[model samples]
Target: MSTKQIEKSTTEIQIPKDVKVNLKGSMLQVQGPLGKVYKNFKKIPVLIQINDNKILLRKTGERKKHQAILNTAKSLIQTLCTGVVDGFTIKMKIVYSHFPVTVKVEAKKVLIKNFQGERAPRISMIKGDTKVVVKGDDVIITGPVLTDVSQTAANIQLKSKVKNKDHRVFLDGIYRYSKSKGIEE
Candidate 1:
């Protein structure tokens, strides 16, 4: 019989002053001035120990994959800290091929008109302190948190996607240009 061996590593992380961390089982909750965030991990072999002002992550067993999990956990913690401290932002651009599309923000809804010359205008809901604005062909989105801002922008882009058509031929749609403090494509 052949035996399999695994290796593991350890990492330590410090919680920022603006961030508050609460742990129960494999679930973690981080709260700050901006908002509260929650995350759950399944069968995490690593051990997380919290002291007075510091949080430590220790990898147990001999599993090399635990290192990746530890890094992901550290990243999530860092994101929570930064998000609570300064928040995040995302930006998108609206383009058109045949007809120019008009983008506008009204109250808590973002409206898109003349898209593919559709009879009805498309709308997307805005959340929290997120704001959507149209400056020429550029759509600017900002919020106190990354999820709200990025999701709002994505919703607008998804609503404008041209389905069952060649992307090169029918290129009139909204697209993401840049993202800050959050995931963007």
Candidate 2:
């Protein structure tokens, strides 16, 4: 049996007019109306080219792992485009049995108090320029970078996890209810 050899592959990403992308060596900077985002692709064995309104990610390797990395880079670039342009938002809801839980946004971290009637407060570190806003019973998290915004939301959810208690019955914690940019539940 004869095997066909693939010469090369490329991924193209189209961006909006208001967004600006700059590539300096392995570091990429994206600026938009919402904010700015930066990513480093130092280890990825792929070539990145940016145009006026589009980007091209070229992959020349035929290895399976290389293909995976190229796909991942492509997806990451797409996310960066969307995040810089439209931004990302995640909404969480505070639910408790009786003690009542409160979420506070500090300078660089989020403090979750009275979680499951616990006296000690749980803290979640905010990444990048992610903003956490506590309004009534809703916690709104927004940012221009997908990684930062999603990581902050994950930190908050994981920090308030119910320990020792049965998860099905003791559902008293901060749970993500809604989100944008394909993040939900």
Candidate 3:
């Protein structure tokens, strides 16, 4: 009996007009009108290639683990492409039932002053290359990378989380309302 090997799984993504994808060894960089995003896939068990205006990602074997990684790489590359072009943004709203919470961006940290009438300010570190802006009751987080932008927003939300109290009664925290770049929940 002759043994047959399964074909590898492949995924293709079309590149946009205003975006440029550069592959240097294992590092992939995408630059576009919005900004640039870079990621390393050296340790992943997958192959990435840019052909013309398309991106090809494939796995050598048909194992479950390899397939998972292949899909992850594909999604990451697609996110990078979208981020570089349209960019990523998260909108958060500050709501306070009792004490008004003041948000400020200081250096690489977000300072939450007078949260729940606390004496000291709660600090949250900004991750990656994310930019945070406070306008009245609205908080805008923007970045070329989706992960960084979302993480930074999450950090702010977590920092102002209400502890040891009823969430319904004490609704004084920063909450994410919307997310852009084709990613929303």
Best-performing candidate as measured by TM-score? 2
> What tens digits encode model 2's per-residue C-alpha lDDT throughout 22-54?
999999998987778889999888899997788
Question: Residue 57 deviation, candidate 1, in Å?
Answer: 1.4
Each prediction's RMSD to truth: 4.8, 3.1, 3.2
Model 2, residue 22: C-alpha shift (Å): 0.9
Give the TM-score of each candidate. 0.73, 0.89, 0.88
The candidate, 1 or 2, that scores higher on lDDT is 2
Judged by whole-model lDDT over C-alpha atoms, candidate 3 comes out at: 0.86
Task: Report the C-alpha lDDT of model 1 over 86-138, residue by residue, as the tens digit.
Answer: 67767787888787799888999988888888878898888767767778888
Better candidate by TM-score, 2 or 3 = 2
Candidate 3 lDDT over residue span 122-178, tens digit each:
999998878888999999888889889988998899999999999988889999998
The alpha-carbon lDDT assigned to residue 32 of candidate 2 equals 83
- How many pairs in model 2 have backbone atoms within 3 A of each other, for residues 3 or more apart or on separate chains, i.e. clashes? 0
Model 2's alpha-carbon lDDT is 0.85
Worst 10 residues of 3 by lDDT: 1-10
TM-score of 2: 0.89
lDDT of each: 0.75, 0.85, 0.86
User: Which ranges in model 1 have alpha carbons more than 4 Å from their true place?
Assistant: 1-8, 42-45, 104-111, 123-136, 144-148, 182-185
